[model samples]
Target chain A: METEKLFEITAYTENQVGLLSAIAGIFTRRSLNIEKLLVYPSQIAGIHKFKIITRAAEAQIQTVVLQIEKKVDVIKSYYEVDNERSCREIDDVRQFLQERETESNNI
Target chain B: MEQKITGAEAFWRSLLEEQVKVVFGYPGGQIMPVYDHYWNYQAQIRHVLVRHEQGAIHAAQGYARASGIPGMVLVTSGPGATNVVTGVADAMIDSTPVVVVAGQVPCQLLGKDAFQEIDLIGMATPITKWSYQIRRAEDVAWAVSRAFYIARTGRPGPVVLDFTKDAQAGLVDYAPKPCHFIRSYVPDPQVSESQLDEAARMIDEARKPFVVYGQGILLSGAEKELAAFLEKGAIPAGSTLLGLGALDSGNPHLKGMLGMHGNLAPNVMTQHCDLLVAVGMRFDDRVTGKLDTYARQARIIHIDIDPSEIGKLVPVDLGIVGDARKVLAGLTERIAPRTTREWQMEPILCDAVEKHKVIEPEIQPGTGEINPGEVVACVAEAVKGEALIVTDVGQNQMLAARYSRFVRPHSFISSGGLGTMGFGLPAAIGAKIAAPERTVVVFLGDGGLQMTFQEMGTIMQEGTDVKIVLLNNNWLGNVRMWQQLFFQERYSCTRMLNPEFTGIAQAYGIPSLHVETREELPSAIRQMFAQEGPFLLDVHVREESMVFPMIPPGSSVDEIMLNNEDWFNYGD
Candidate 1:
């Protein structure tokens, strides 16, 4: 049996309703729990990005990412082992978003 | 100036633009607007009113499988939408192309839990090729076209469109939105020349090559290509259940069906071959019993249109992601032609053993209660392998697959991947309606027949010339067989006190006959085909009858049970 580890999955998709649940359902069907999930508009116009953190075997994560990309709205999806550097990068992105929100409020 | 029309009118117009002439549907409160407009388009589109919502979707699946077009379905919200979910899942797994439009509660009532409101898109997402909610009239044309396009292209599957009541009643300037492409979707991947060359080299080098295929060949319209590929390599091929009609049953290169209840030769040859070429069929557990032992001696090559399916199950040495037609044609051109090989005689030996041990006793039993396989053979003889054959799940399905002969593509339709029990009757209705010129015969067990027998009402109303053959055994024969073998005869809930089916057929205004003795079998089948709009022939098969040459679940393909006391030992 393969060892389970925390993996971060990134998916780019069209801005369509119910797609978040559609992608998440793949994980749920496999009985994998999501530790964190973030859905937001991406830098590319009309595209949405989803960052999900889950613990699963690498083989299961490969299929889950493939199934997520199989959805009609999903443009692409990738998964990789989550590490301290990647975790810091996620926090930095969150902090950058908060700073942008504060600046917009000041305006 | 754009033509302003209601969303319901747009729905009909969009169907017209897609050249869809028939739709199977049921109506309720939320979908009343669409039904109201359906009246105006009656002259252009023929809508078959099914007995239930499940019947509607299964019929659409049948129509799609028969006509090689996306079957269209319309249903109301809540129960109506939920009812079709089983058939939708069936079509998804079987790769049948069907488009379903279900009415939802108005947009405002979506999340508020209003009357007849449910999250249909959420429910359908996992099972459909694509699922979208049309909340506005403007999105109807686009969504409908997109749904049909997605449902019918590449590896075909079911698609769902949730039409809110407001969308049905809303007005929009309607224009045909023809969808041929989606930016995120690549329906057909290009064939890789390097992979084809590698596959050809492997096929050429292998001493014993075997091919196991599935419904992908028919879905790709590559029956001729498959035949050519097999002929060029002089390879024997076995078909998955859904792949039955893709190759003519009499084709010399065609071995037989492959699965738990499939033929002896293919299962045995699977263990003996050195190279395995799989086309279009997934490595379903039923086909590959105990995957660890499945073709372990063979270097497998999997060719499929879907990228996810290539390495999903049995890892392949060469995985070609492309249309079956293109890949087969490419490989055929590259591979060398062979005349004969030592492996060619393997099936002949297996066939001899099977004919004496299994086939003769089941299909040509001289004395005793009528056997289910006998009925299938009689029907095959009556139709001369010309009729469209449909089957429900379990023993009847296996018997039909074993005995029925097909000379053309798309002549056999069954619930393959999902094994939906009630699929046969409604699917027969759809097949007959889709191809009125051909005879449509459905073989279902007593258990499966009752699951969707209400579709007889639909058949009676539409005058669909479908022949219904019920293999009545008074038990869920397949499960009963398993119980006897694996579960120590603990029948559990396998027994059924079946109703007098002929009486039910009579009530539905359908001609009926019941065959109990072996003598009545041939004539009863003849009477069914003699002169009929629709006829039901129920044969009471042996209560303890079992489908033999069986690969008991979890056993390797070669570990076959030939009879109650005998197991097949190769070269015995």
Candidate 2:
């Protein structure tokens, strides 16, 4: 199985304890393992941000974004799929190598 | 014959008649009439004059969470009303029942840019269960009654009622009507027979089945039902952090906590289980580790109170959206008790337990310098099953969660959702107030203790028998720990200027104990517990201590940095 690259999403929130637990609970009930999460006060006055990383399919990523929007304190949440370029390039190389090998074998 | 009364007087009288013992608030110009009416009911009801309007709301929250009754708070126009927003949001997240009454500017001046005028109803709309602005004196009784009704029913949350100056001052013959506004808020507890059957079949067929419980169990008051279900089915269960006390930790079927920093058994079982039954908990990233790998082998059955939680994350084979107590009771009635003895699943569970046990940290026995871990471990060992422990935010909170052995439900109360730093002190006050007979211990770091340190006066004034264990690290340990791990040890603002906590405690007229060593902890704790009134234990602890097995931000659970040298040696 190919190892999928994980992406981290960070959302700013008001400083509250249950906020992280609520966010984590959302992921737990959905059976999503948060790879890593860090929450602290933001540079902006009085706001706190939680940076969470997890691995999921592209479809599931969209679902997570929507689910996060429903959280009470979340002001904004954004995520970038890390290592997408490397992953796509690796897949392309593998496919190219396989096709070349198949042609040689036929010859 | 009933005498004629103004709307404000009638509202206060109705509240007093309902046996509302106290109201938390601060007074202001727009609310002068209401406060005047409030004086007449002073004999029947008490008013706590809080320094900050926000504090009043939080105090009410403490009372409600402790007493399991709807808490009441009254704040005056504009800034006074806006100050209570934090408390409202806090109550909403924790499912605390609170009724916040905010004084609005006069009706005629509402949109005329009057001083201290605000659209509080609009500001509080998203955070409250329901919100209303009383336009007329006749509407006062209905609004107050409805606010209480909506706050206490269903999932239970905060409600706001903005009373116009006119409504508070307007005179009309008023009689309080019975609350009928919450008729639609009632929740259905029973799961359909088909849903029950499907969940049962999934449980019976799976080889490695695991159960995950959340705060919904407590919200639904389904502890007894859940315990019975787990015992009968012999299903190994784990709880989300919020679900800490749902099942007794000593119960053979219980698998401790699940998620980031969760027990190894639950984390591994989650991945290997053929079937997973998640009750009342929304899937959170901390619990699941990595979505792609989480419960890959399991067909999920999600039972929750909120309908939106279903299929929000992991796809569920069966979704039962109702109250946890009702659904579990229904499942128990329909499903036959099954023994996993035939499958001999005990060894699998035992092996998981045996593999995950951390060897006791090698420190010189009875060393005077307090190791933060040992102090936490000792507290866990001492309290074991009795005290309801609340921790402030930062490393202290994480350490407490890690070391504390929670054997009963509601035993561990931390700001899991918000991770609010000052939460521990006030929450402990609330928990103790809720269950006075039960000892409440609050653990706080030096930094966290300072945030809501003012509440120390509240404790002294109430003569509450709550114990505060201060972990004096001399710095914001969590940020410093992260700095050490990720920021190359350049500690910035994490260093905290010292305070004489013992003197602060003494100034509050509370007994104080100071401990600088692990040997001193038990005796200090004993001394504090033996005291007649509230006590604070200021324990000096190592500032450099870090929580191990930390999954660095954006990393998977398997990529944990185990600080325990033995666990690393054992190749875990």
Candidate 3:
């Protein structure tokens, strides 16, 4: 089995409560677990956006978007994949490399 | 032919006919036309000019929550409208009925990179129950009506109506059709009898039954129905934070609030009950600490007006989607009331009372420093079921929740879902303005008070006779408490320096009372209620006090660490 990584997806909606519930309902019915979710107004264009972190496959992501669009208030849905090359990953790598350097210096 | 009137005039007239008494707003360039119209209808509708647009929206929220009526807010285009987004979102989360009207740039200038031409509809989409952009002047009445309907109807929340400059200025052959608009959007409040019977049967048959009430009690004007149901059934009722005023605090059937910082009795009973009847509340994580363990002992029945809310979190054994008051009324009519295992339930109530008595902090009569709990209890006792209480975020809110005694729906107002600071003062002002007959009080910490302390001007200007009870702990009490417990007393930026709140209130032309000792509280409260205009009672409390039985974030309800527990005995 492949290791699943949690990715935060920002789905834009026309700020309505039922929209978030409907989108979550889609994932819920499919047995997709949402790890963490936060919905707030976006900085741009004032559309309501959700930051939902869930563990699912790429195919599942596409399906989530399609289902989300079916909700009356949702305008668009997109994901921010948690990649190793991301800034968070870079911080981790830096810490690991620094630890190695410290060990070598001690030796 | 009908007399020609601008859309702004039609909007104002429609609002007046709807019995809208007050509107909170700050004027700006694009929205000047509406303000111009506001000048004409000054007799019917009073417009309060807030220092900040955000404050105006929050005031509307305060008013809405207090009055049980939809609050109206008006803001200009661009930054003016954008600033109110937080207030609208706050109202949405807390389920306060608010109608936000924003002035947009001219229709022709839209998408033309014109100044103050931001998409108000697009911006307000997520933070509103419903949002609409009015392009034509003729649509003004319909849009305003729709906004009010969406705001005050089932699952009440904030609704936004963005009027283009052209729409506001354009003339229309307008006849104010208030009755027609209301008739078109009025929600049917009937529930299926079979479903109601099934729900009642489940409640009747259960060995241990628990009832959970939320903001829907106030929104549906169902306090009478809820109280009657609890009284007749003998079933214990618990409330979400937003549901504080649904049942009287001293009611024998009441089980206190259920959540992260909820009483031990309610939390324990939630898990122990056999049948859990959740009305008008989505089982948010705050209410149900850990999903799997929440109501583990119960078979749940969820009832809400919004179909989406039913079974959104914990799976329900029976889901009834309808208005809470109507569903409950139907259920009450169909089902004969029966006693459960009275012996088993009596012990639970006794234990809860015993625990409450034990946990209540004792105060010495002449102590120079005030006890936060005692002050809250004092205010709660002073208000005595008459005042509308609003609380700011942090320890003040929790303390108010724990200690305050509320007897009716819409009496306790706070930003529950968003937990926004600087919310209490403005909200209290709005509440007081909305319900001038009733006393309005706000419980605010030193830190939270300063965040929107500028609203002192709103109270002064409006001459709102609101009593602000400031719990002066001189610190960000909740964060400091958390730091002491979790981070080994690494108090960072949590410590707040000083402010003479009494002096500040005096500057705003409001009378001030300073209570340093517990003995002074009774007299201070008396003085506060006696005064004419707005008053501030600054109670100087002990800084090191912490709210106990706190279930830390991401922790299970059963894993709560009581104050009696040793530091090492942290985990369940």
Off by over 4 Å in 3: A1-107, B177-190, B343-358, B362-368, B564-572
Tell how far residue B325 is off in model 3, in angstroms.
1.1
The lDDT, on a scale of 0 to 1, for candidate 1 is: 0.91
Report the C-alpha lDDT of model 1 over B74-116, residue by residue, as the tens digit. 9999999999999999999999999999999998877999988
Q: Give the candidate order by descending TM-score.
A: 1, 3, 2
Residue A68, model 3: Cα distance from true site in angstroms: 7.3
Candidate 1 similarity to native, TM-score: 0.95
Highest-scoring model, lDDT: 1
In candidate 2 chain B, what residue range of length 10 has the lowest lDDT sum? B563-572
Candidate 3: docking tier = incorrect
Q: What is residue B499's positional error in candidate 1, in angstroms?
A: 2.1
DockQ of each: 0.27, 0.03, 0.02
| Index of the highest-TM-score prediction | 1
Interface RMSD score of each model: 9.4, 19.9, 20.9
Residue-level lDDT tens digits of model 3 in B235-344: 88888998988887878778678787777667767777899999988887888887877877789999887655655567789988788888878777765676554625
What fraction of the true interface does each of the listed models get right, in terms of native contacts kept? 0.54, 0.02, 0.00
Candidates' chain B TM-scores in the order shown: 0.99, 0.91, 0.94
Candidate 2 DockQ vs. native: 0.03
Q: Over the stretch A8-104, how does candidate 3's per-residue lDDT look in tens digits?
A: 7766565543465556666776788988889887654446668788887765665576446434355555566754333453244345345545654
